[model samples]
Target chain A: MKIITTVKELKEYVKNIDKSIGFVPTMGALHQGHTKLIKQAREENEIVVVSIFLNPTQFLKGEDLDKYPKKDEADKKICQLSGVDVMFFPSVDEIYTDDEVSILAPCVRGFVLEGFSRPGHFNGVLTVVMKLLNIVNPTRAYFGKKDAQQLYLIKLMARQFFMSVQIVAVDTQRESDGLALSSRNVYLSKEERQEALKIPQSLHLCAKLVSKNIRDRDEIVQKMKEILNPLELSYVEILNRNFEVIKEVELGNSVVLVEAKVGSTRLLDNIWL
Target chain B: MKIITTVKELKEYVKNIDKSIGFVPTMGALHQGHTKLIKQAREENEIVVVSIFLNPTQFLKGEDLDKYPKKDEADKKICQLSGVDVMFFPSVDEIYTDDEVSILAPCVRGFVLEGFSRPGHFNGVLTVVMKLLNIVNPTRAYFGKKDAQQLYLIKLMARQFFMSVQIVAVDTQRESDGLALSSRNVYLSKEERQEALKIPQSLHLCAKLVSKNIRDRDEIVQKMKEILNPLELSYVEILNRNFEVIKEVELGNSVVLVEAKVGSTRLLDNIWL
Candidate 1:
């Protein structure tokens, strides 16, 4: 596998490949979730490109911009083992410059859910994703359903801007205990790791309720809240595919999302019905 | 020349043609200025595509969006005569949707000169241009130096996003009477038309002074102001290519810009050294 760091090199490397290309963009410190995305991309395309950038703009001022985990050596090994054709690890300076044009998230849809909890986060994500998409110019780009809101926003951007690449959303990967795999999982202590399971447990309960014909959104949320008792819950929202809150859950279109604090780290999990 | 009114048709048409594409985006009302851009695109690439979209987002609430000139029949004839391969004329609905992801201009460079007069104008321009560029996926894109700030911002967006298309800046086109050619000129009465000539006249006077080795920015602006007297002047400033106000003009990097209101219509013109 080729390891590239600069945008120019990556562009030159991908410019001549005539085969169907698939791209997977992520931050470093790869986990099972990232592996799932890469494996899916490998299965679907003749060439798979993975970008690992810990973008600073996505982190708020007091957020974990400085302390975010970076496992560069292990990530390279994982990509090599996962059949990645190229692994892009660009430095901040190589990808961005001072006083540049930025991409903004959708006004309404981008400002709710994850955007509400972390304002301006999707803006940074959209901006960086746009740059990566332009540089890669892949035939298809892969995104995991774990970041459901992000996947939706990216789909919106691609359609709005008329980008040519197809966005392929892979299913979310989970642990044996039903906890969604996240790079941030490394931040959890032994005790806090056990508490993080409650996040997915709450989402699972909501999914079970909806599957059993519990159509009322309020009732589903209330039941999930009860199961999430004693934990500092950020929000338990029942939203349609567009992230708008709905009164009744539409079987195939509904999503139940939850966020909570486990120790000092925040965990997010969602179930798309 | 084929004329396409829908995005889907345009994309399909362009996809079948296996040749290098050069694109020029405009807002109908073809004038000598627009022809210069289209003509250059035709000369440079195997296929040339022109789009006429009167973007509403670029116009402020009370701006001249509705009053903006539209000469569709004339524009179509001009495109055919200029040897354009494809002319895309998408309606407002075909080009825009309810909520969208937008492109914001660079902080400092995007908010000066014309951007200063119209606060969010560049944001709209950049957003639409981004959409058109993605839709066309051209080998090269052409813009007239008549809209100097807009050209600079587009170039910046292409580079900042690592977009692959090459941007070519065609020189400004003028009439026999020295008035800068603009579609908006149709809004000017005969009297207002005569008054518009002073804009380019003042800019020429500044160019003559700079040729005589008068390099001070303020002195040249003051001299141009003398010639623009009795007219409602918006601004007359000199800046470097980076759009920063310079104390002394560097011969190859200087740009002298002027904006003035001829009756109710505001006009802009610039000379790049």
Candidate 2:
């Protein structure tokens, strides 16, 4: 696999190839979730390009901007093993400059759920995604549904901007114990790791309740809060695919989302109905 | 020439072609300046696309959005005569949706001259430009140096975002009497049109003084203001190409800009050193 670190070189590398490109953008410290995304991209296109950038703008001040995990050697190995054609490992200077153009997320949709806790987080996420999309000019970009809101907003951006790239959402990768895989998972201590299981357990219960047709928004939320009790819960929302609040779950169109702190690390998990 | 009105149709139309495309985005009332831009695009590319969108977002409330002159039929004829391959004319609904993604201007550069009077104006210009560029996916996008600040910001955005499209700045077009061509010139009455001559005259005087090796920014600005006297002046700034205030004008790297109201119509003019 060819590794490119500068935008000019990567753009030059991709410019001449007239084949379908599938791109997977992620922060380093690749996990099973990232592996699934890359594997799916590999299977779908003639070229699969993976970008590992720990975007600083996405992290709010006092957040884990400094301590975010980095596993460069392991990530390169993983990309090679997964059949990635190109690995883009750009430094912050290569990707961003001072007083540059930025993107603002959708006002209403962006300010809810994950957005509420981290106010301008999606701005950073969408800005970096946009820059990467332009740089790669990939035919299809793969994003896991694990970051459901981010995926949705990205798809929205592609559609609204009339971008040629097709956005594909892969199913979330999970542990045997049902905990969603996340880079932040490494930050949890042994006890916090065990407590993190409650996050998915709560989602599993919500899924079970949903399967049993007890999908009333308030009732399901109440039960979810109960399952999530004794742990600090940020929010538990039951919304439609449009990210709008609904009275009851609409099968195949609802998403139940939850966020909580395990020790000092925050984890996100959700189920697409 | 084919005229595409919807983003879907336009994207589909441009998807498979294997030729260079040159794009010119404009709000209608296509005058000599737009014709010059389109003609340059036609000469430089295999396909030339001209988009006429009177973007409302760029216009502050109570601005000239409604009164901004529309010469659609004339503009179409000009594009056809200029050898344009496609004309994209989209309505507000086709271009924008509720609370969607947006682009914010760069902090310092975006807020100086044009952005100063119309705060958040570049945001709208960039949002639409970004959308149009993505829809057209041109090889080269053309902008007139007439809108110097806009051109600079667009170039900055393309560079900052690593956009593959090459931004080509065409020379500014002017009227016989030395006034910079603009659609807003239509709002000028016969008397006001004559008064507007002082704008270019001031710039001409500044250029002549600089040619005589009088390069002090403050002295030149003061002299230009004397010539622009008794006209409601907005601002007159002489600065380096990077938009920073410079004490002395560098022969090849300075720009003298002027903005003033001619009977309540705001007009802008500039000279690139």
Candidate 3:
């Protein structure tokens, strides 16, 4: 359980190792979701690396870049208990310079749904992910399905760039009550916590409708919006797996994505049928 | 030399070999300059791979993409003669799809000099280079110093992204008459060919001034401009090795770059001190 903080050290360390490495990249505040990713990485490879850097670029000007949670000791403990070989906990300055290369998301897929409200969000995610992937050079990288759009875009980037690393998508880890686990879940007050359940509850309802062969996109969205009533809803999109808008849901190929603001914290949850 | 036309095949081929590879990426119509890069790649590593891709993204909307020169058979012969182990020649469709990930250049370093005249040019160059580098995953990649800014940006990108590939800068290959070798020299007619001599001649004068201990940037640029007179000069500037404008040339670190057009064909030449 070695903790490395600089990109150079991580690169050198990863370079010297001869085993196949599995990588899990995350922002700090390790929780059940992150534990799930690390546990899976531990199972799959001779070496497992987990990077916990709070990326600043991914946050917009008004977003909570400063208030992002940090639990370094707990994260380190999690990685150690998960059998992780190395933990990359780089500083913001170490990861980004004043002037450096950046990655841009595709216009269509990147500018819809999550991207519409939070423009340039994926660009930052992609830029940091690329930096981490290049630094680690892992054999396989684990990404949770909780950030469904981010996962899809990462997989797209890996293929489009012909990257050698295999991107593996782990299922979304959720609470027993069906609320998808997120680090920001802590931002919720007692009442807001109960309110946040509407997000996952909406998705659960959409899944039930989808299971019942309710394939119409409009009907599904309308029903989910009812479940999300009075919440500060950003969007309820029914799109194919490719992120393209479809007239109707195609079972096993469609995704019902929801983004809502519970109190001041924004949460994203989706069901990939 | 074995030629690979698809990304999948090239990845598989490069993956099976367990030797250090040196890569040189080109836009075909190989001249003495490309020959120098490939030849250097040949000497440095156990395996040498050359990619001949005329990346369309690097060309601007009104640029001569259609008129860009291509001599595939001759280029192949040159690669074979130069002892290249693998030649990757991918079609536009094979390398790119309708939707894909792209790389963006840094604002200051990317938008000056050549970048100013041709906006968004470095974006295209950086994007394609990233793709090719990922696909090949070579130990060392070769670039010429003629396109000084491009070389700098690519090196910066590799560093900023923590790319595994080592970017090695080769000196500019020149003709006996001091003209920098370029594939676009074919676009020059007999008269325009001689007119193109002014570009290198201007750089030669700039270097001669620096050798005489005359370090004033204005004086050096003025002298070069005199030699480049009546040639439809685009720009004559002096800057530090880091692309910053310098009042006085730094004895150990400076570059004098020139970009001018002859009969609507752009030519670039520079000297590094």
lDDT for A238 (candidate 2): 87
Model 3 Cα lDDT, one tens digit per residue, A60-90: 9989988888888988888888888899999
Indicate which candidate wins on DockQ.
Answer: 1
TM-score of each: 0.98, 0.98, 0.98
Model 1 misplacement above 4 A: none
Instruction: Give one digit per residue, the lDDT tens place, for model 2 in B1-273.
Output: 999999889988898798999999999899889888988888899999999999998999989887889989999998899899899999999999997999999999999888999998999999999999988989999998878889999999999998889999988899989999999998999999999999999999998998899988889999999989889887899878888889999988988899899998999999999
Better of 2 and 3 by lDDT: 2
Those runs of model 3 whose alpha carbons end farther than 4 Å from true positions after fitting are none
| Rank by DockQ (best first) | 1, 2, 3
User: What does candidate 2 score in Cα RMSD to the true structure?
Assistant: 1.2
lDDT of 2 by residue, A113-198 (tens): 89999999999999999999999999999998988899999999998998888999999999899889999999999998988888
Tens digits of per-residue lDDT for model 1 on A194-258? 88888888888887887798889888888888888878877889889977889999988977888
lDDT score, residue B197, model 3?
96
Q: Using lDDT, give the best candidate's number.
A: 2
* Model 2 Cα shift for residue B63 (angstroms): 0.4
In candidate 2, which residue pairs clash? none
Candidate 1 structure, TM-score to reference: 0.98
Model 3 residue-pair collision total: 0
